[model samples]
Target: MNKLISVVAVVVGTAAALPASAQITSGSIAQNKAECQAQFRVSDLNGDNFLTPREISLFRGSMPTELSGREVIHRQDFISACYATLPQDD
Candidate 1:
């Protein structure tokens, strides 16, 4: 009886923890693309095709650590990074 109870408890605990660790989707590719484009357009103040480090800093409070070494950000690169930072759905 004790062994059966322990098994059931373990199974229940595992099931309960699954949802907590699940990865939430950011959004569809189209949605993310649109959002990223809009963000880039607004941040590209100089009408240049690429974003300077200063522009990026002003747009986002601070650039992500992964982009620390980048001197310039192209449209596609900016979009990809924007998509990556999107909030995950609960």
Candidate 2:
């Protein structure tokens, strides 16, 4: 019984000494905008700074609602929505 208790205590102590996992940070607006812009640039494909319906499909639900009926998504509009529409680290 004493040996079992000692082993259990040691295991608990070792676990307590280990570092806790780091929490993810919600990035600043500027950082988020930059990231979104980069993704948009890659998805643009044609370098026209506008995403057509087919390109918009790549982003799926991440695109802003204002773009629903539009034929194309402008770069500025996408950057504007990044803060509110995109999922952030919580």
Candidate with top lDDT is 2
Candidate 1 residues 22-58, lDDT tens each?
A: 3112221223444556555555656577879876655
Worst 10 residues of 2 by lDDT: 21-30
Candidate 1, residue 84: lDDT = 75
Q: What are the lDDT scores of the predictions, listed in order?
A: 0.55, 0.56
RMSD of each: 17.9, 17.5
TM-score of each: 0.47, 0.49
**Residue-level lDDT tens digits of model 2 in 1-90:** 996586456434543443332111112222454456555554464567898887676555555565577778888877676656656788
- For model 2, the stretches where C-alpha displacement exceeds 4 angstroms are 1-31, 86-90
Model 1, TM vs. native: 0.47
In candidate 1, position 86 carries an lDDT of 65
Error of 1 at 50 (Å): 0.6
